[model samples]
Target: MAYSHDSVADIRSESFPDYEARIEDAYIEGYDPASLGAPHSSLHTRKLWFGLGLILAALFGIGLSVWGAAAHIWGTGTQIDLSNRLLVLGLIEVAVTLTLGFVLIASSRKGYKEYRKRTGRVN
Candidate 1:
């Protein structure tokens, strides 16, 4: 008797794949999860600070845009409509910052989970 096995699932099922998530998971799995507890969490503190800074900067830019709009800077000669674009650009900056913030938050969560899984640290 002979038996055969397929190495991979059929392509038609690709639509249901979790490829991107799996890739991200694989990358995260390569890290040392045992070092994620409190004292060691400091390793990620810098990232948190950086992320905070980004959010602050984005907020500052948006504030500036709002101020410009309130002041009607776009109505000024030669600068007309410029403030509108500036505001739009500021909004874009905020959006990007928000995205990065979410990513950082998720990474932190993954880190904590990994730490718990590897070192039995509960937090």
Candidate 2:
């Protein structure tokens, strides 16, 4: 008589087709449970602070970029040609900052949800 054996990796892959992708997503979003060592509540608080910091920084960057762009377009006394170049650069900066802000906000929300689920909190 012979017995069959299956490896853990094989079992996991068969059970969850997207297991690796899910793990990657969790890490990329900064909510990997494996990386959390503190108590659940403490981890939640730290995650909140980290997420808030990112959002605040992004907001500040966006505000500065918008101010710079506005100044380049109307406030600056430079020549039209130079001003146009600066204006374009400033606009690009504003767009980049906006995108980063959005990404940060989304990451924050996703991480918060993950934290709630892990802690079994409804609110």
Candidate 3:
């Protein structure tokens, strides 16, 4: 929504004074938008999309593992060695998939918090 000064609430929250350096200083001196679930001036559109893509990929990896297990694609065709083969493959899949998921979460959280701090916002 476009915020206009005619609105009373907008005057208080969306308000800024008529000065160039003052506005920049205000942002640099702690302009957090955590109430919006986002830190202000830290995340650009492209970076957010990239992070979202990483999370989507991790979820896809998990889904593929489930499909492989259910279809016995995780196992060798040999009748006798099928169980052991599936077990090994399943373990490998779990390890890699979980590791990727964890890394994605950690990296995103760290990056977000660091951005907030760097922009002078208190978490």
Per-residue CA lDDT of model 3 for 9-116, tens digit only, reads 646445775653423354444454554455333244454546555555655556555655655755545554354455456556656656665565555466557655
Which model scores highest in lDDT?
1
Candidate 2's C-alpha runs over 4 A off are 1-80, 117-123
What ranking emerges by TM-score with the best candidate at the front? 1, 3, 2
Give per-model TM-scores: 0.50, 0.37, 0.38
Report how far residue 123 has shifted in candidate 3, in Å.
4.7
What lDDT does candidate 3 reach at residue 73? Answer: 52
Give the alpha carbon lDDT tens digit for every residue of 19-117 in model 2. Answer: 333333334444445435533333445445665565565555555556667776576665443544555565566566556656655654676577567
Per-residue lDDT of 1-123 in model 1, one digit per residue for the tens? Answer: 455556656787786766443222443433544445544363466666666677777787688668567646436566445666667777787799877976765665665577568755454
